[model samples]
Target: MERETLHRYRDIIPDFDAFLQAIRSERITAVRWNPHKVSRARLIEELEECFECVEEVKWYEHAFRLGYEEKPGKTLHHILGHYYIQEESAMVAALVLNPRKHAVVLDMCAAPGGKTTQLSALMENTGTIIANDKAIPRLKSLVANVSRLACLNVSITWNDATKIQAKECFDYVLVDAPCTAEGNLQERITLMPRRMRESLSRLQRNLLAKACELVKPKGIVVYCTCTFAPEENERVVSSILERYNVKLEPLKLKVPHAKGIESFGREQYGCEMRKTARIYPHHLNSGGAYIAKLKKRG
Candidate 1:
């Protein structure tokens, strides 16, 4: 991306060289969308998944324009489910959530069922996961995804992740709250960084409260976002601390290589920030992400 774009956020310190390398490594062609699939509904859905609706569509077409390259989904990774075509770094939330067998987990905002399915895998398919999203249309996709994943421990529910009942019941809740997604700017620059500040802050608190509210006494809540802005990530964690006695959970990331892990804080949420981890595109071959593990102190 652009330096001006990277300078605004604390997490991003992009290396254009590496960026180029990543692009070169990508299996998907950088083409625009296929003309045949350009309906309003399809466009909107892909936009949500890709975030960079216009450019991504263009890139899809651009890729197609180059030639009839094989789609990534049709590859072995999709069959193995080793890697998923998720909302970019959205997978981080599930990794951060880390559900255990016999636990009751709820993925608030679980439509498209990415995190929910992951949680099922994490729990060894022994725990229960209530996957909830408000949109009926999106719910169908969620159901389809969970079914495709063969997730036996999941139950599909149609409810707004924020306003639903079921307080203090879940052993763990992954509130990967909706935000303006500044980290997503590499693709969605049309949505500016400054404009995302307010939305990020607001959703942070709402997500924290909702997640904290549902966590069983002494249960853990992992809050995450794709955006790197501290106002959203840490401030949201801080807000949760102000309202409840919560402690940050340390993230043990052994797979992907990370850098400058110490650069972020320990107590931004009113306690030491030792138990949290944040990853940027610069840190590893991953999209930008902020992850914090919060335990309800009760």
Candidate 2:
């Protein structure tokens, strides 16, 4: 991690040393049980024989925190669509969205389909989910995960999400926009260039705007990112609120989290930006993530 990047989060993140240490430490393995394929109790019973540990996430009944050595993916249960390997914090977006059964949903940038599959599971495979992504190669993995997870209701599309020509088309929309991956330090990835970060934020703003356009009036759009940068998280959301008739809704998850940054440097975001949730690695002993729930006004 660069000193400059670390400095940006120093004040905004409480216990900065702990935050740094947490990211530098080993990443926790977590997975959400696929209710479409198996019951949580049954999955646990099956996994108990293979792995030394299988513990349920207290707040999320379908999610479980696996022991460090457990490779949930290697098991036959996973091959049979028993569960999906996902970060603990990353699961919050779909849970907060709480899509109704048979609702039409759009997962903008749905490559690798973690949340899209979660949305399918939440909807009980009854609703339509347009799982669209721009990258063709990544979309292949998305399709595979959707198939392996037995997500029957998702229709995969390859396109620029911001260019989608639809209005009031979906009951719910999720803009899990592409970000700098600042929060995914578990992978030990390099810091992205400033230009790349700026470009991503621009794309994020456009995708979010399109999401607002596609969702029905009074519908919900849940914006999330696996990055801690305010530019990509709160600022992108702040700009959307300025252009759209939408209000930030409180995320009522029970996981430990910090409130979003209202201002970074001299730029002050909307007061409602505080309603967004920021989860640091130290907060949940998992990878960092940001989630903001928005409801379109009638």
Candidate 3:
């Protein structure tokens, strides 16, 4: 991590030392069972022989936290589409969206389909999901995951989410916006360039605005990111609330989390910003994430 980046988070993150320690430690590997393809009980029974430990995620019935030595993807179950290797915190967005059966949904930036497939499973393949992404190349992975997961309800499209033609058509929309990826310290990737970070924040704002526009009145939009940066998380959602008729709704997640910051630097966001949840690596013993649920007012 950069010295400047460490300094930036020093004041904002409480227990900064623990946060630093957590990010530097090994990341927990987790996977969510594909209920569409297999029963959770049966999957766990099958994996019991292979894994030293396979414990269910208390918050999500279909998810399991694997032992450190477990290689979930290499298992026959994964090859057969019985499960998805997803970070437990990343699953929060789809769970927060809570797409109802037969409800129209949109995954604004749905490539590599972790949340997209999860949405399909939640809907039980009954509703339609317009899964759109700007990058055509990434669509292959998206398509593979959806196909593997047997998600027939999803329709893939290649386009910028901000420019999508559909308006007020979806009951639920997810903007798992691109961000600085500061929370994914487990990957050991370089810090995002300052220029790219600024650009991504702008893109996140536009995508979230479009999500608010695409959902029906009284519908829900769930915005989330894998980074700890408020600029990409709460701040972007705050910007959307200022420009749109959406109100922040409390996320009813069972997992451990920190409340979103109402004031970042001198700027104070709406009080409702506290409804958002911020998951740190230290808090969950997993990668970090931020999630906010919003409802569009009529």
Candidate 4:
């Protein structure tokens, strides 16, 4: 881990010591039950057989934290698509989106379909979801997961989300853009070069701005990333707010999280940045993420 890269967040993150400790701690293993395949009770019953601990994550329904030694991915139930081995914090995006049944939605950069499958479960497999990824190599995993989870209403596509030629075509759009993933400290930490971060920021802004264009008037667009960089999170979103007709909306999430920072370094963002939520490793004993919900104006 680059100490300097993380030290930059010292003043911005509350209880900085706890944040550092949580990032260095062993990652929590969690899974979300597949409502399309099995009932919660039945899945928990099955999970208990393989792992000694199967405690529900109180903040989110159908998600549970497993024993550190237990591998949920190896279980037969998992092979059958009974549950998804997703990080607890990663589940927040779909919960915040809350796409309704029978609505039209687009999941831009939806490879490896964690949130995409969760969206399908939330919509009860009734709505249409266009699951897309720009990278051709990643689509295989996305297709497999959507199938395993019984996401009957989903249609897969391969396209650069920023270049999609759709206009006002969806009721909801999810821009879970690719990022530096600084939040996944549990995996490994590496120095992020300034040039690379800037390049990703440009890509993120384009993808999110395109999402705003694709969503219908008064429709929702949720942008999220697994990194804590304000350049990628707040700055990119602030740019969109300036150019687009979308407004930030308060996220009615039940999970514990920090509000987005209004200022980062010398950059000053609008107070509305506070409406966005920041999930820290300390908050969930999982990974970190930043989520912002926007509604296109009529």
Q: Please say which candidate is ahead in TM-score: 2 or 3.
A: 2
Q: Model 2, 1-298: lDDT tens per residue?
A: 3434555678899889888888888777888889989887899998787788878778888887777854668889988989889989899999888999999999998999999999999899997999999999999999999999989999999999989987998999999989988888754545677788789999999999999999999999999998888888988999999989999998787999999988988889967888999999998788889999999999
- RMSD, candidate 4, Å: 1.5
lDDT per residue (tens digit) for residues 53-90 in model 4: 88988888789999574567888999999999999999
- Candidate number achieving the greatest TM-score relative to the actual structure: 4
Scored against the true structure, residue 290 in model 1 reaches a CA lDDT of 73
For model 1, how does the per-residue alpha-carbon lDDT over 1-298 read when each residue is reduced to its tens digit?
4323444432433465554344234222222222222443553454345332223323122121112234535533234333335443455567667788889998888888767776776686787898988789889988877776667889998876777776899999888777666555554334344546767588668868888888998998888777666667777776677678677766776434232233334433443543556665544334567778888887
lDDT of 3 at 184: 84
Stretches > 4 Å off in candidate 1: 1-4, 10-70, 75-83, 86-89, 187-196, 255-271
Ranking of models by lDDT: 4, 2, 3, 1
Off by over 4 Å in 3: 1-3, 187-190
Residue pairs with backbone overlap in model 3? none
Q: Which residue window of length 10 is worst by lDDT in model 1? A: 59-68
TM-scores for all candidates: the values are 0.70, 0.96, 0.95, 0.97
